[model samples]
Target: MAAPLDLDQLQTFIAIADTGSFTRAAEEVHRTQSAVSMQMRRLEERIGKQLFEKDGRVNRLSEDGERLLAYARRMLRLNRETIAAFDDRRLEGHVRIGTPDDYADRFLPEIMARFARSNPRVELSVICEPTVNLVEQIRRGTLDLALVTHDDEKGQSEVVRHEPLLWVASSNHAVHEEEVLPLAVGRPTCVWRRAAIDMLDQMERDYRVLFTSWSATVIIASVISGLAVSVLPECALRPGMRVLGESDGFGTLPDCRIGLMRGHTGQPAIVEALARHVSESLDNITLPASEEAGMFDFAAMMAMRPRRHRPNMMPGW
Candidate 1:
């Protein structure tokens, strides 16, 4: 007869795989590093194979670990769904969500505020991280939901919204003629960076990444100050930025797909509600008209308004 697997050990193994550090995983699971190590050892002994290679500074999954990740994810998701099914009340517990920092700063506040109005009793915890990190956290049960860029190679999740990607630069910056295209890009694994680079490569354009940061504000600031250019969602552009003219050979970049993803669980009400709110909010967003003919004049009213700090102002406010 086959031996029964230890659920606790499996959870530990999954945590280690997701976090890539035993110490971090131990802290997340509320166990000591030694305890996490012992659980993994016991799991490996039962399975008769080493799940991870501990040679490097960071713990890397072995062939066995990679093979078991799918099963572990399925089992954990099922466990959570089963528990939720029994406690099918008004979702009074906490719902932890993760999003890219840009999305959190730009669009998430309004959606969350609306959600709060509807579910006042439910607690919401939002974490802002890179898309890859957020996806890993969701898979590891650390987050209840996440909105990230959908990669065709990685497959689609439950799509919430999809918007066109637009190239933007400062109004004062010259297009196509600049020696090295100053680009403000997010960190590695950013979809916008990949899309921008791929488009530039295909067009045979010479460019240099002058600035790279994970903050959308940094990207906007650099572009507004005429220091760099960036590509972002059409809805994210603000005043003082300009979309390059197509006559300058700046057009033809492809669109990026952004979506909401959640683990398979029976709590469809919350997911559906959140999805509806996001879709509606994004659809209603209107970008300012372009100043130049055929090109979006994103800086049309740059002088009309002063940047004021309004505490408690939500996104889209």
Candidate 2:
């Protein structure tokens, strides 16, 4: 008969093998060194094989340990899957969601609050990154769903919501022909940065990049401090920022498309519910005239109309 294996012991063994030091493994597992050593000893006894070799002060995984690592990973994954399958009805499965920093800051809190209320047992895992990174993660099956900006030049994915980009700057900054506009931007993969640069180029405006960061907070802070101009969704702008002229002469920077993309085949109903909630939240975003007109859908307007209006009967009647 195969020996019974303990997951905790296996985890400790893997940790020790990876770190090559009991102290490090213990720290990683939030256990004392003696505890880690005890677990490893127990694991070895159960398997009836030496899994590690002590060379001086360092510990190295033996050939048997190397072979068992693969089995350990498979067993752990299966164990987790089994637990999730049984516990899913209680809203306890892990959900991996990806979103850009701007949308995450502006809208995620409210959505998460609503989701939490409905799915009290779910564990939400969020990854905030640029649209490109999020899309890649979604494609790679690392993320369960993503809220990402669409590339206009590229075909659309399953679109959930579409909003337009807007140019914004500090309230104190003035646009002038002589003065060089300082621009704050995110990293290269950011769609907003590309739009900002394209707008500046098309308008024959000379601008200098003053700050660049992947963080929305950093970009907004730089703009708020009167450091630079940036292009962002109208919904992302806070109170202190001012719109630089209404001239669409900068050209349409393309609509910001948000979508829910599943990583692989099977998705929990809770994940789909969260995706729908996110799509619904996008409806609440107010847009400027130019942006609003661009994304206007006849179906949405029809839905907003009052279905029936009854006139009050005259008192004489």
Candidate 3:
């Protein structure tokens, strides 16, 4: 395999190309003239490309040098971004993060894996609960941060992602066609449940609550068993489930606004680290090309992403 390009050498090369003189370029980088010359020699040998050509008494970039200069600047800029991402403190110690049961299943795998890989010494504590309880914990200082369903009426949060709120039913059954629709929904505090009820009421569609739970597993079980239809975000759709659309008289529901709620305490390094990771992961989360497919190619979709490392699956929700 080719050896990795040296960042320091690239820095020096960029300096020489900019200053057009070894002595001044050395002064620009705070290196001795001989040292700068040595670095350039090594850089040329490393790439087998002569980056500088003599022009009168000054140094001018060869065609390869001009091409490499752009790449060098980009690499250094990325290095700065990478360093800035970690908060300015030792990122260690335990951080507590909460999310609803549904979000835990749909998003935590990538969030937890990426955070743990980046900050191995920083311990993580996770809680799976309803968004109401998660919001309360943030206020009470019992949690460092939370991934929540954003509601501006309730409080402030950083909205990170939005997903379509979909009416869903079991693919194998006709439960949705019942004269009085039986519905499995979350506790009243769930924004998704509220949107589902409000839109149904607006359409004057008759419905009855058959089951209520905060657990995604229970809700999905109710859905897959064809006992009742439910509303869910795009990520929560699973195999054996089908979306109910306008053709089925299911009106449009409000989007699920996923937010990051930080605790009242000023941001700490570890907390900020996890918060950034969660936002980036969720932002990367994508919907299927067709919702009707009812299947997410999880592995195939995420395989192309580069991960520094991954431990075992996150501690159970």
* Tens digits of lDDT, candidate 2, 211-292: 8998889888876677777877655766557555434234555556665666762656867867856754554433344534
Each model's C-alpha lDDT?
0.68, 0.67, 0.77
Estimate, for each residue in 1-317, the C-alpha lDDT of model 1 and write its tens digit. Answer: 98888878888877676555777778889998889888988888998997776543445677788778657865764565455556546456567777777777667866786666556656778888878887888788777778787776787465545566777887766643686676789876787898889888887778898889887788889988888878877656766677664655765555666777885545567766566556545533333344322344644323221221111111110
The residue pairs in collision within model 2 are none
In model 1, pairs of residues that clash are: 290-296, 290-297, 291-297
Q: Which of candidates 1 and 2 reaches a greater TM-score?
A: 1
Q: Model 1: residues >4 Å from true position, as ranges?
A: 1-90, 264-272, 288-317
- Superposed model 3: Cα runs more than 4 Å off: 1-90, 288-317
Best by lDDT: 3
- The deviation in Å at residue 226 for candidate 2 is 1.0
**Which stretches of candidate 2 lie above 4 Å from their native place?**
1-90, 175-178, 247-252, 285-317
TM-score of 3: 0.66
| lDDT over C-alpha atoms for residue 60 of model 2 | 65
